[model samples]
Target: MTAIDIRDVSLEYGEGSGARLILSDISLTVRSGEFLSVIGPSGCGKTTLLRLIAGLVTPTRGAILCGDRKVDRPSRDRAIVFQDYGRALLPWRKIWSNVALPLEGGNIQGAALRERAIELLKVMRLEAVADHYPDQLSGGMQQRVQIARSLAQEPKIWLMDEPFGALDAITRQQLQDEVARLAAERNMTVVFITHDLEEAIYLGDRVVVLGAHPGRVVEEISVDLPKPRDQLTTREDPRFLAHRHHLFGLLQGH
Candidate 1:
């Protein structure tokens, strides 16, 4: 079953002669519980593509459908985690409260909110810092909080834009494994955006590579590698390296 169906979508800015086309004729479908990594050179409108699916932006032509409904506006069903974890989290709010923000309304009440927030924080290994503020935590911890907060939203689809881009190599690798594990465990539909070829290959069930200048899908590859990916073993696998090399070539205009 398809969780998201993007059909011939195109997005343009302005009118008449000044119009700038950001995305062009992008048609892709993300299967339910599939982890899709989108990779391309900078300015390929990767973020714009995410925003369109989030319904934060609309296309100039064609349509985007999340299940049976058209993506016309923002909904809690699609939770987006941006690259800037610092701005994505609230400074004044305690870590637990920040995660609870999504559940503050919409029937969740009182102790239920705290219970849910703590539960998700525990999943992210962030239960230790549940009482600390966002500013008090390290960059990686803060990003974990942002992810936990998104989980609190109970979104049908998770949209992440270069979420681990800023973290140190070790932390990023840890988070990468964590996200892959959680998404598989939860059977979540995720569209992850990244610049790193290996990161895209490591975490994705399939990768969609885009070309720049009115960003469009240039190639899509099935990962085919075994699941429960190991940071060391998976990257060292022959199949993983091939996928990485191909993706690198595509991004490098080979």
Candidate 2:
């Protein structure tokens, strides 16, 4: 069940000698309901790849297919969660209202929208702050709200770009587990981007390492750990350490 097929993709900015190539000959298939984490050094075009799948940008060459359809523009089927939750949410709207924003455009209205928002808020453990504004919440709570809002879209694929990079270590781990749980319970397909090797290995079913200088897949390793990953046990597992070592070496050009 391939959810996304990116075929021989290449992205270039500008034209002629001034052209800057970002991604070269990139190809990969993302299975439905699979959790894929992408890690790379700075300027690897990791976020660009995500934006490409989100239909926010087009590859200068090759095509990207979502299911049987070719991706040309952004659709509700794909939802993106950015690192900057403050900018992502509308401060004017309440936490619940922000979560329900997507549903308002559709046929759902009134109590139905509120009910849906509350449901997702509870999933994110954000029920306590349902009526509060984004400004009133902590960074972690704000990020949770953003996650809840993304869920409100009920997207087939979730594209998260360094979603917890700015949070404290403790909060990051908590949200990592939360996201893993939600994705599993909802049977979601997620494309998570991060610079943290341990974070990637901890949450991903498969970790895709991208190389810089025209980003392309360097290595893709499957995580053999058990589901409902334990932060303590999973990270301390020999297999987890092995993956961390391998990916670290790959990134370091060892």
Q: Estimate each model's TM-score.
A: 0.98, 0.98
Q: In model 1, which range of ten residues has the least summed lDDT?
A: 105-114
List, residue by residue over 1-254, the lDDT tens digit for candidate 2: 99999999999999999999999999999999999999999999999999999999999999999999999999999999998999999999999999999888798888988988999899888988899999999999999999999998989999999999999999999999999998998899999999999999999999999999989999999999999899999999999999999999999998
Q: How well does candidate 2 match the true structure, expressed as C-alpha RMSD? A: 1.0
| Whole-model lDDT, model 1 | 0.94
Highest lDDT model number: 2
For model 2, what is the C-alpha lDDT against the true structure?
A: 0.95
Instruction: Report how far off residue 120 is in candidate 1 (Å).
Output: 1.4
| lDDT of model 2, residue 154 | 89
Clashing pairs in 1: none
RMSD of each candidate relative to the true structure: 0.9, 1.0
Candidate 1 at residue 237, lDDT?
Answer: 98
lDDT of each: 0.94, 0.95
